[model samples]
Target: MISEKERNVFEGMAIPQILLSYNNGKIKIELVSDSFCNMTEIDRDSIQNNVAELVHPDDLASLSVCFLKFVEEHSNLDVMFRVLDKKRNCYILIHGTGLWQLMEDGTEMILFYFDDTRRIQNSIRHIYSCLKEKDPKAEYNDAVTGLPNLKYMRRFADEKLNSFGACITQQVLIYIGVKSMRSYNDRYGYDKGDALMLLIAKTIKEEFPSSFCGRAVEDHFVIMDEFYGYENVINKINSINQKIKKNAYGITEGIRAGAYVVNPEIKAMNAFDHVRQALKDIGKDMNVICRFYSDERDGELLTERHIIESFEEAMEKKMIRVFYHPIICTKTLKIYAIEALARWIDPLRGMISPGEFIPVLSRYHLLYKLDLYMVEQVCREFEVRKKSGLPLIPVTVNISAQDFDYVDVPEKLRKILEKYGIDSDNIIVEITEQDIAKGTDSFKKQLCSIRENGYRLWIDDFGSGYSSLNVLGQYDIDRIKFDMAFLRHIDDNNGKNRRIMKAIVNMCRELEIHTLAEGVETESQLEFLQEIECELAQGFYFSYPKPIEETKKC
Candidate 1:
C-alpha cells in the first residue's frame, strides 16, 4: 500500500531501496545507488537487481539457510550477493540488508537496503585466485583432491575454537581422505588426478553441506561434521563407495571416510583435526571408520605444545647435547665410526626423543638451527679427540632433506671441518632415504659436492620410509644404515619385510656400497645380519648408545 508520495519519498531517501510487501509478493525498488549517484561510472542499480538473477548456484542453498537462521536469530536483514549480469558481461556484489517493522495489525514486514559493495568483488577475486593456483607436488595438499591441508586444517580449527563465542571442545569430527592417491596419479596424469579431487570435493559438499572438508595431504582429506554425526554421513559415503566400485575406474579407486566425534567444547582444525586421531584409534578396521576423541586426552595435545616450546628454549640454552654413539666394523669389532645423536635432557622432564621434536622442527623450518648446532657440536668434539690423540673415528651427523636443498650446507660442513682441523674422513654426513626421493637432483648434487672433498656420505634409515630402489643412482652415498625395525621384524620371522631388507642389502653390495644396521638388540639378529656379510653395524646388541663417560665405562 505504498502511495505515489511514499514511493517518491523512498526513492528520494538517498539509499538503494527494495520494498518487499508481505501482502502480494510485490517487490518495488527505488534507484538511489545508481550510475548517476555512483560517481565511479558504475551502474549500481542494475548491479543490485542483477544479483537476484545471478546468485551462485552452489551457494544459493547455503545462503538461503543462512538467511533463515539470520532472520530467526536476529532481525538484522543484511545480505551480500556476488552475481553476474543477465548477459554475463561482468559480475557484481550486491550487499542487501533488511529492516523489519511490526504494523498495527501485528503483521511483520521486512524491507532491505543495499550496503557497501566495494570489498565484495575483492574477496571473490582472492578466493578464485587461491583455487586457480595449482600445485601438484605440494606435500601439504592432496594434489588429487582439492582439500584442506594438515597445516591449514589445524590452524583453522585452533583459531576458530580459540574464539570466545565459538563451540566447545567436544564436537564430533570426521576425517575423509582418498586411499592411494599416488597410484591413481601414476596411472593417470595430474589432470585426471585433479578431476578425482574435484569429484571428491563435490561429493562431500553435496552430501554434507554443513561439514567442513579440507585436504590434509596428497591423499588425505579431513571432514568435520555434526554427530548424530557418523550416522548422518556414513550411509552416503558407503553408497559413494559402491558407485565408485562400479564406475569406469572401477574398484581400482577407493574413497575412504573416517569419522571422529568430539564434545561440543572440542575445537576443530576447521573441525577435521578433532576427528583425525579418533578414526586412527581403530587402525586397520577401515569399515568401522567412525570414532570419537576422548576428552581425557588433552594431555597429548598439551604435551605437543610443550615440546615445541621447550625444544625451542632448550636449543637456545644449548641444553640439547650431542652424544656420540659408536658404530663398529662388524668384521673388525673395532670403533671406526660413531653417530652424533642430538639429545635434549630437559631440566624438569628429562630426556626428549629426537623423533618427537624433529618433525616439529622440520614443520616450523627450525631444522636449520638444529643442523647448525650439530655441526658446531661435532666440530668441537672432533677438536677434543684430536688434542687427546684418541682414534679419529668418523662422526656421522644427520642432514635433513630440507638442508640438502640448501646450497650452503656443504660449505657450512666444510667450514666446521676446517675450523676444527678435523680430517675430511672424520665427518660423515647422513641423508635419509626420503630426502633423496623427494629432492633427487639437488640431493645428489649436494652429496656429490661433499663426497668429492674426501668426506663420506651415508643414507640413514635406508630400509625405511619411502626408501627407493634407485637410491644409489638417485643420490651419491657410500653407505646405507638399515632401519632398526628390520632387525626386530626379521627376528620375528617377518618374511616379506626380511626379504626386502636382503634385496636392499644385495643391491648395495652389487653397487659396492657399505651397509650398516641400527638397533641390533639381540644376539640372533646380529649373527643373522653378520651372516649376510653386513660391513658395519650399530645397536645395543654390540654396544648401547652412550655419552663419552658411558662409552669409557663400557
Candidate 2:
C-alpha cells in the first residue's frame, strides 16, 4: 500500500504525478503512481539514483535553484521548464514547487514535477494560460455597448466548455437582459435609458464580484465565468433581484437570463443551443435566473405551446386522462390517498407522461383549466366510489405554480367540487418544490388559502429544490413528500451530499408535520430510513404510478 502523503497526489490524477525525496547527493523517486509511470515511460527502481538524472541538461541548474529556494525559503516556486524523458527526448515540463517534510523529522526537501503540459500554450515560450489568447478584434462584440457580442460568446465559450464540451465548471452561464430598457428609452428619454443601462452593467459588476459583466446585446448583459455554483446560484440569483429592488431606481431591473454550462468536450457552437434552452427555461419570466434552455428543463414549455393549440381538442375531445399513484399509509401499507397524476392521451402518442406536457400547460396558463378538469374527474371518481358503497378515499391532485395564483383557481375548484357533491376535504393540492421556491408570497398565500379551505397542501420533490428549510418549515404545507434524493444518498457514507438530505428530514420531522419520502428504490435505503425512525414513505418499493384501474389490479 502507498503511504498517505504519496497517495494523495496519485489518487485523483487520472493523468500523472511523482513524489521524490532527496538527501545529500543521494536521490530517490519514492513513488510514482500508475499515471505517472505510464506517462514517463520509466520504472521507479531505475530512476532512484540522482534526482538530476531526469532533468534536461539545460534545465538542471534552473531546476536545482527552484529546489533550493523551496527548501530554504519554504515558499512555492511554480517553474515550467523542459525535461528529458526516458528516451532522452526533451518535452514540456511542469513543477509544483513546495518544501515537503520527509518523515516529520524536519528534514524537508524540494517538491517539483516533470511535465506541466495541461494548461494553455506557452504565450512567451514559458508558462501556459488556460484561455487561448485570441486576436482581440476577432471575438464577439455588441454593437451597442462595444462589448464582446453574442458572436463572441462562442469565442469565450471555447475556453470554459467542460471535458464533456458542456459549459459546467463556470458553475453556470448567466445571460442577463434588462427588459423594458427600450421602454425606458421611449418614456424617460434615451439618455436616461442609456444611463440606466450603464448603471445596470455597473451594478452587475459590483454585485457579482468575479463575474464577467459585459453588455452582450443592445439591452442585455452577460456575466461569464465561474461566477456561481449549481447549488447556491438559484438563491444568489434571487438575492440579486432583491438587491435591484433596493438599489435600482427607474431602471426597474428586468433581467432575463439563459444560463448553461457547456458540456465539457462539447464544441462551442453547439453550446449556444444550451444557452438558448436556458432562455426558454426562464420562459417569459423577466426576472428569473438559473434556468436551462434545453428540453432537459421544463419540457413543458414547448409542450405547453403545443398544448395551447391543442387544449380545445384535449378538453372537448377527451384527450387528457388521470393516472393515479397510491399515496399509501406507510405503516399499514394501505392506500389512503391517491395522487391524481395528469396524463396526456394524445391521439397519436396514446399516453404521455406529465413530463411531456405539464410544462406546456403551465406555460400557456391552461393549467387552471387542466387542473380543474382533473379535480372534476377525481371528484367524480370519489363520488362514484361513494355511491357504489366503495370507500370515499381522498384524492390528491398536483397544481401548477401559475394556477395557484390565478384568480379563478379557487372559484373553479369550488364549482367543480360542488357539482360533483364531493367535499373540499376529499381534495388535496400538491405543488412541486421548485414551484414554491420560485413562487411569490401570493403563490404561498394561494396555497395556504386552498389548505385553509379544508384541502391539504403538500410539497413534492422536497430535496430537489431551493427552500429546503422553507419547504420543511417556512412555507405553509401539510406534508412533505421527501424527495427520494434523500434515500438515494444512504449508499454514500462520505457524508458529502446525504447530510443535506438528513437535515431536511430531521427538520421536517421536528416541525410535527408529516414527512413522506418518495422514490424509495432500495431495501437497504428503506432500512436506513427505518433505522432513523422515519415513518412515512413512497416509491417503487411501495408502489409505482399507474392508472386508477391498473392500480386496482396491483
Candidate 3:
C-alpha cells in the first residue's frame, strides 16, 4: 500500500490521479483524487474498491493487457483508454500514465496521472484556428471562399461512404461549375471574382443545409447530401443559381451542376469524378443547368480514359493515321484541297470514330499533340507524292484553339514544313470559326503570323456559332467552310436556310473569301451548292475520307 505522504502527494496534484494496490492476482482501488472524481463525475463512494467498473467496457481488454505488460516488465504504464462518465452516461478518451512502487507488505502501489484526450484535442484546435486566421490559405479550406476544399471533401466523403453500408439512405454527390467564369473574372476584377466564389459557397451551404459543401476548384463547388429525388436536387440548384444571379452584382453566367447518386461499386474520390463526367456531358451550352450521371455517360468516361491512356502508345506505333477528305472545285470537278483528318485505327478496337476521340482530346488539351502530328504527317505525304510524281494538292489540317496555347503555331508549322523540305503553300491551316471567335490577342497574333508566313488559313465550320459575320470582318481568312447544319436543315422553315446559305455564299464571294460547303451528300445538296456558286464542296457524295495512298488515287 502507498504510505500516507505518497497518497497525499498523488491526491494533491492538480491533474486527475488515481491510486491502486495489487496483491496476489487481484486489484484494489486505494484512493482517488478530487480532480479525477470531478472529471469523471464518479464519487469515491460509488467507485468503492471496483475501479475497473469505471473503465469503458470496450476498453477493458486493452486496459488489462496494458496493466499486465506494466507489471511483468516493471515498465512505466503509458496507455490510452476510455473512462466511463457515469453522470453523463458517456465515455471520455483518457491518456493514463503511471509508475509502480513495490510496497513494504508484499503489495504493489500504482500512481496514475490521467489526461482527457478531448481537452488536448480542443487545445490543438484552438491553436489551429489562430493559425488559420493568420493565414487564409490554410490546408483543408479554400482561401478564396473560406469553405472546406477538395482535400477536406475527400476525407469527409470517405467517412460518409464508410458508414453508408449500414444505412439505407442514398446520398447524392454534386459538382457545380460556373460557366464563363474566366470571362467574368476578366471583366470584373479578381477581388470581385473571389467575392463571387464566396457568395456561391454561402448560397450552396444555405440551399443544401444538411449537405457537406466544399470548393472543388476555382468557380467549382461540390456538395453531398441525402438524395430525396432528382426534382428536389434540380430545384435546389435552380434556386442556388437564382440567388447567385441576384446577389452577384450583375453576373450573367449561371452555374451548371452534375449529380451522381452514391453507389456501392465506386470509392469516395470516384464519386466526384462521376459527377464531373456528368457535367462534361452538358458541354458548353449555357442553357443546361443540371445533369445526372448515367451508365451511358460512365461508359463514355471509361472510353475517354482508355483514349487518354492509349494516346501516347498509339502515336508511337503510328496508329493515329491521317486520312485526307478531298475538297473539290465545283466548277472543274477536280480536287482543290484535301482536308487532313485524324483516324485512330486501334489494333484491338479497329477504327475509332473522330466523334468519339476528338472532343475527349479537346477537353483534356491533348489535341495539340494530335494536331501537330497531323501536320507532320501531311508534310510527309507531300514528300511521298513528290517522290512518286503523284499530283499534290494543298492539304488543310484542322487546328484546335488549344493548339496555340501549347505551341507557337506558325513557328511549329514552319519547322515541320522545313523538316519535310515542303513549302508552306503545300499545307493550309484550318481553324474552326468558333475557335476564331474566341479572338484572344495571342490567337489573333498566331493567325496573323501563319498568314504572314505564307500558310493559308481557312475558317472551318462557318455559321456554326453566333459570331460568323463578326469573324469574317475581323480576320483575314482565305476560305469559308460552311457548317453542315445549314445543309442538313436546308429545306426546313420554307427554305429559310436555303435563302441564308445563298446570301452567305454571295457575301463570301463579294468579300473575295472563297467558300466551301461541306457535308454535301445527295444530288440535291450538290445541285444547291452548284447553284449558289459555292467555289468548293466536299462530302460523301464525292468520297469519304481515305488513307493517304487512296487519296492520291482520287
Candidate 4:
C-alpha cells in the first residue's frame, strides 16, 4: 500500500528490496525491485505468487522465526538465510534487514532487502587457512621454516642410530650454532630473526640436500650424515658459512660446529650430549670453527654422567674412595705429604678418574659435596692411622671455586677436623691459581681464615693461566705447583719452556714461597727441576696416585 511518491523513492534507491503481504501464516509477494529479481534471476511473477518457493529448505525454519519476531515486536527485522536461485541452481547466502509497516486498510506488510553473504564466507575461509595442518604425516615440521622440529628429528636420529649396524660408527651428527643471535634478535626484530632463520634453512637444504636437517632449538641446527672425517665436515661448514654471508642477511655473523661419531653401544640421546660436549670444549674460542667427537672424550663424558647419576649412592656405599699421590721433598728425597684425590670405584663400571668426574661435579653445582666428602675421608684416614700407630703425614685436599658458593668453607673444614679429633694443620687445602685469580672477596677471606687457623695453603697448577709474581704479594700462599703443561712443552721451540720455568722458580724462591713441579716422569725432567731448585715435586716418577693401602708399599 506504498503511495506513488514512496514507491518511486524506493525504486530510485540503489538497494535490492521486496514487499510482502502477510495474512495468517500465508505470505504473498506484492512488489519486487528490478534489482532483486535480476540478482535472483527470478521474474517478478514467479516470486509474487509465493516467495517461500525460492527460499532454501534448510533456511525456511529460521526465516519463519524472523518473521514471527517481527510481527510480535512490530519493529525492525534482521536475519541471515540462504536462498536457492532456481535459474542458476545454486544456494546464495543473504543478509536481510526490514521493517514491519501498517497500511491504510489496516493490513500489515514487511519491507526488506538483502546483501550478498559472499564476503562473510570468504572471511571464514581465511580464518580456517591460518590453522591448516602443516605436517599431515606428523613429522612435526615447523610451520614457518618448513624444517623438521626437535621432536621429529630426535625420533629420526634414534631410529637411524638404532638400525645402522656397523656403519653407525662412520656416521656423524653436526650441530651449528649462530653466534650472538639473541642480541641480533633484540636489535633488529623478530621478523628479521625469522627471516634469517629461513635463509639459513634454505641454504642448508641447498648445501646438504641428502642430509637430514632440522632445527634443534633456537639458533641451533642439526645435520646428520655420513662424512669422511672432521676435514670433510669442516669443508662443508665453511662452505655453508660463506654462502650465508654472501646471501641476503648481510649482518656479520659467524657459525661454530660440533660433531658426534655414532656410538652403537650407547643410546642416541647420550650421543647427542656428546656433540654438545664438543661445542662446550671449543665454542668459546672463536678461532676454532668445527670440532669432531673423539672416543676418549666420549668415554669421559659417559663416565662423568654415570658418576653424577650414581654419586649419592656411591658415597653411601663407600664407592668414592680417596687416593693419595706422594709429594717428595727434594732435599730429603722422601715422602713429605700426599695430595688427596677422589676416585669413583664403581663396582659395576670399574674405576672412574678424577679428571672425568670433577668437571661434571662443577657443572651440576655438586662440587661442594665432593669437596666435603674428600675432606671427611682425609680426616677419617688420619684418625685411623693415628689409632693404628702408623705414621701420619699432612694431606693436601684440593677445593673447587664452586665450593665457596655452597658453604662456609672455613667453618665446614673446622667441623670436619674437630669431628675426627684432628688439628687443622694436619690437612692442607690446595686451590687453583685460576680460582684465586678471580680475586673474589669470599675466596680471600676463606684462605685467610684457613691460614690463621694454622693450616697451610698451596696454589695448585700455578703458571697455568694468568699467573704472575704479583699474585704472591696479593695472598699468603705456601707453595706454587708448576703445571704439567709447562713440562710437556719444555723443549718446544728450542727450550722456551725451560727458560720460563727457571725464571718462574727463581722468582718464587726470591719471594720465599715454596715451589713444587708436577709431571716429572723422565729423569731428565727430574734433573732439570732438581737443578732449578724446585723445593717439592709429585709425578709418576715418584709414585702414581694410589689407594691408602698401597701407600705403605711405596
Candidate 5:
C-alpha cells in the first residue's frame, strides 16, 4: 500500500496521474492528482473510486485488454483512450503510461501517468480559434466548398463504425482524386480552381445525397456511404464526372475514384488508407477510372511500401547493382552501346524485380535517386573496364520524367562523370517518348541543357506512344530506340506492323537520326532490321541484361 507521504507527493504533483488498485479483476482508483481533476474538470468523488465509469464505453474493451496484457507479462502498460470531461460535456483523448507493482497487501497497484497535452497544444488552439473566427461551422466545414472537412468526415465515420453493433450496415469509402487539377489551376487561376472544386463538391453532394462527403485535401475528395453494389457506385461516379465536366467552366479534367468496403474490424482512418491505395494502383491509366481494394492489392501496397522504405538502405549497402544489356550492331553483331538497368537484390527478400520496384519509385517521385545512382555506377564501371583492359562503349542511362523535377539532371550527370574521370561522350542519356509528350518548358530546356553539356541524347521506347513522330521533329536527338511493342507485334495485321517498323527506321536513317530496334530475339527479326538498314539491335538475341562482371566477358 502507498504510504501517506507517497500518496501526498503523488496528489500534489502537477502532472496528471492516477493510482489504481486491482483486486479480483476489479479496478478501484485509490488516488488522483490535482492536475488530473483540473485538466478533466471531473470531481475527485466521481472517479476516485470508479475509474471505469470515466472511460469512453467504446474504448473500455481496449483498455481492459491493455491491463490484461500487462498483468500477464508484468510489463509497462501504454494505451490511448478517451476520458470523459464533465465540464466540457465531451471526451478528451488521453495517452496513459502505467507501471504496476505487487503491493504488500496482495493487491496489484498501477500508477498511470495521463497526458492530455494534445487538447491544450498551441497548434490545436490556434486552429480552433482561426476556424471559429471564420464561421460557427468552420471547424467541420471546408471554407472553399462548404463541404465537411477531413476531420469531420473521420469523426462521422468513426461514430458510424462505433455504433456498428447497434446498427450493422455495409458501407464503403470512396476516394476521388482530381486529375490535371494542377495544370488546370496553372491555366486558369486559384479563384477558378476554387470554383472548379466547388463544382465537383456540389456534383458529389447531389449524386450521393445521403452520403457523408468531404474535401480531403487539394483536389481530393472522400465519401462514406452505404454499400449499394459495385455497379451502382461506378455508375454514380460516372454521372458525377459527366456533370462536373459539363459545368466545370471549360475544365476537362475528370476525377479518378478508388473504393474500399468498410470493415468494422478496422479503424476509420485505415479505411481511407485502403481506398487511397486502390486509387494509387489506378495510376495514370485512363482506362481505369475506378478501382476497388482487394487483398491482393493490399499485399502489393505493402510490398511497395517495403520497397520505398528499404530504398535508402539498399543504396547504402550496395544492394542496388547496375546491370548492362548490350545494344548490338545489326550488321556486325558488335556491341554499339549498353543500356544500364538497375537490379535490386535485397538480402532479405532476395531478387526484387525491376517491374515491381521501378513503378513504385516512379509513382513516389523517387526515381531521381535511382537514376543518379545508376549514373555514378556507370562511371565507376567505366573505370573498372579501363583497369581491366576491356573495350569502352557508350553506356545509356534512362532518366524518368519525374527525375527532371527532382534534380538538375545535366548538372548532376556532369559532376558524376568528372568525379570518376570519365568523359561525357562515353555516357548516353535516354528518355521515353511519353516523357517528351509532356512538353513542359522546363523539361524541354533540361533536354537541351543535357546535350549542351556533351552527353549524347537518345529517345527510348519510340513508337510506344502517339507523340513519337512529333518528338523527333521537335528535339535534336542522336538515336531513336524502337519500343519492344513494335517488335512484339511485328507479325500482327498481316505484315502491317513490319511495314510500319521499316518505314520508321528508313525515315530515321534518311533524317540522319540513328535507329535501333530493341527486343530482336530471332534471326528473322535481325535480318529484317538489317534489311531496313537499322543501325543497331538489342535483345536476348544478342545478350540479356547481365551483371557488370559477366558483361565484361561478352
Candidate 6:
C-alpha cells in the first residue's frame, strides 16, 4: 500500500523522524529515517527492539503517558523531553510530535521526531536576548527572587515615572535590606540562603501588591509605591519584622526598611538614591527599624561621585592641599607638633569638605591614594617650609585602616620618606585605636617596623570606638590622643564622661604613655584638661587648621 515515492519523500526529509507501532502492549519502532539513525548514532537493527531503552529514564514515564493520551484521543502529540542515544550516557534534549495513522492493513502507527534539543535551547536563548534588548527589565531579572535586578530596577523607575499620565501624591521608594546575610549563608548552606531569599521575596510581593518590587542586588529589595503614611508603613514594617523574626531560621539579625518620598521633579534614579542613602543611615542599629531620607543627611551621592571621579586629577593639580592644626604642650603652651589634615578645593565645585569626601573615598577603596597623596604633600610642604626659612615642625599624618589591609604601609611610608630625603623622626604615623585593635599580627609587626624606623606611632581617636585598652599593651604606640567626645562635658567633674576620662588619663600615665586631648574648644574645657594633667591638646581655641603657606607667613 506504501508507494516507493512516499517512502523516498519521507527519507529525503532533513529532520530526524521515526514511526512507532503498538504490538503486545509495547511500542516498537517500525520505520526510522536515515537522518534519525545518524543523529541518534544508532542503526535500524540495534534500535528495533531497544527503542524503550533510548528514552531517558526520567522522561520515559511522561512519554508513555503522553503516548497513551495521544492514542486514546487520536490527537496530535507535542512533547518536549530528553532522550538518550547509543552512548547511553549522553542525552539529547528533544521536541517530538507524533501523529497517529491507520494503515490500509488495519494496523495503527505513530510518526514523530525532529531536530536535536540543543537547537531549540539556542533558539529560545536568541529570542530572550532580543526581548531583553527591547525591554531591559526582561533581561536582568533575579533567578532566585523572580524580581527585577538592580540594573532593571533603575531603568524601570525612570520609565514608570515618564509614563505616568498624572501626578501621584506621596509616592515613595522603600529599600528593604537584610543585614549579615553573607554570615548567615556561611553558617547555613547556599540552598538555605536561596530559600530564605525566596521566602523574603514572596513575603514582600504578597505584602505590597500595589508596589513595584525588585531585588537591588543581594539582600537588598526595593519597593516603589504610594506612601502608606509614616505611621501605617511603620506598623506594616513592624508586622513584617515579627513575621520574619518568628520564622527566622535561627537568624538573630532582622531586616530594616528605609523610605524616600518621591520628588517628582527629581529623576526616579535619584529618588531611589535617596532611599539607599536613608538605608545606609539606618545601619546596624537593631533598635531602629526604618529611617526616612532627610536633606540634612551628610553628603549627596552626586558630590561623592564627583570627588571619586576627579580624585586623581585633583591630586595631580595639587587641588588637595595639606593643612596642619597645632597640638601644643598643655604645660608649656608651645607648638610641639601639628596634625596633617587633607583639604580639597575643587576648581569647579569650590571647597569640598573632608567630612563629605573622605568617606566616599574609603567606601570605594580609594582612600589609600588620598592617604599616600597626603604623605607626599606633607613631605613636599616640609621642604618648602624649610627652604622658605620657616621652621620644619614634625607632622603627624593619619593612615587609614584600609591602607594597612592592602598595601605595605610601613614600607610605602619609608619609601616616600626616603624619596623626600626626610627623616622618619620628623614624620609621625598616626593610626586609629580601631585600626590597632582590629589589626592582625602582620599589621602589628608593620606598626613596630614603622616605630623601629624612627617614626613615632600615635593612636588617634583612642577613646572614640569600642577599642580595648589592651591595644596599648599590644602595639608599640608612643601616644594616645583621647577623642574629643571624652572631653565634651569634662567641665562637670561629677559626670561619668569626666570620670572615665580621668581614669583613662591615669591608666595612660601608669603605662608611661603621653595623652593628648583633642577638640579643646572652650577656655573651661582647656582648663579642665590641664587640671587632669593632659600632656598636649589641639582645638579651635589655639588656631584653626591652616595651610603650610599660611602658617609660614604667620
Q: How many steric overlaps are in each model, in order? A: 28, 30, 0, 0, 0, 1
Query: What lDDT score belongs to each candidate, Candidate 1 first?
Result: 0.66, 0.63, 0.84, 0.80, 0.84, 0.80
Rate residue 471 of model 1 by lDDT. 63
Worst 10 residues of 2 by lDDT: 123-132
TM-score of 2: 0.47
Instruction: Please give the lDDT score for candidate 3.
Output: 0.84
Q: Write the per-residue lDDT of candidate 6 for residues 435-527, one digit (tens) a residue.
A: 778888877777788889898989998878666988888877789998888777664557888778778889889998889989888888888
Stretches off by above 4 angstroms in model 2 are: 1-305, 386-391, 438-441, 468-476, 493-506
lDDT (0-100) at residue 125 of candidate 4? 56
Tens digits of per-residue lDDT, candidate 1, 1-554, equal 55677656665666655555444544334334332234223455564465445565644665577567655675575454544544546644556667776645676666666644555446755765576575443534543454666666555666544442245433445566666676564333344566776776776677768767776666566655554544556686776655555552423456766565544454454245545665556567756644555555456666667777776688778789888788877777788688898888888878877777787788777787788788888888766666666666678888887876554788888887788777788778887887766776666677778889888888888767676777687556788888887877773654666677777788888988889988877777777677778888798876666665455521
lDDT of 3 by residue, 1-554 (tens): 35799778766777888777776866677878888888778887776656778787767886798789987787898776777788788877677798986666766688788877677768867987898888756878876787888777766778766665346888888999998886565444344677888889999989999877889877789887888999999999999999999999656577989999888567887877789988988987767799999988778878888899999999989999988788988888899888889999999889989999998898899999999988888887786777777678788999998988989988998898888888888888898888898868998998999999998889888888655587888878899889998898899999898999899889888899989999889989988888989989999999999886775564
Candidate 2 C-alpha lDDT tens digits along 1-554: 34686566554466555565666754556655566555556665555554467666666775678666665675766654554466545453544444464555556554444444434224322321222244455345442345566666655656644522343344556676665565454333344565666666666766678765566657766665563455565665566666665665454655666776544455656555566567655656645566755544545445545667887788777688777777665566666777787778888657766775766666567777887788877876775565566556778887778876666566678888889787888888888888887878877676666777788888888667464464555666788777766667755778554566566567767787777777777777666556555566677887777765555532
Estimate the lDDT of model 6.
0.80
Better of 3 and 5 by lDDT: 5
Candidate scoring better on lDDT of 4 and 5: 5
How does residue 343 of candidate 4 score in lDDT? Answer: 90
For candidate 4, report its TM-score.
0.65
Model 2: lDDT to the true structure: 0.63
Q: Candidate 1: misplaced stretches above 4 Å?
A: 1-291, 385-390, 491-507
lDDT of 2 at 29: 62
| Candidate 3 wrong stretches, greater than 4 Å | 1-163, 167-228, 232-258, 275-290, 386-389, 552-554
Clashing pairs in 3: none
lDDT of 4 at 545: 92
Error of 3 at 434 (Å): 1.8
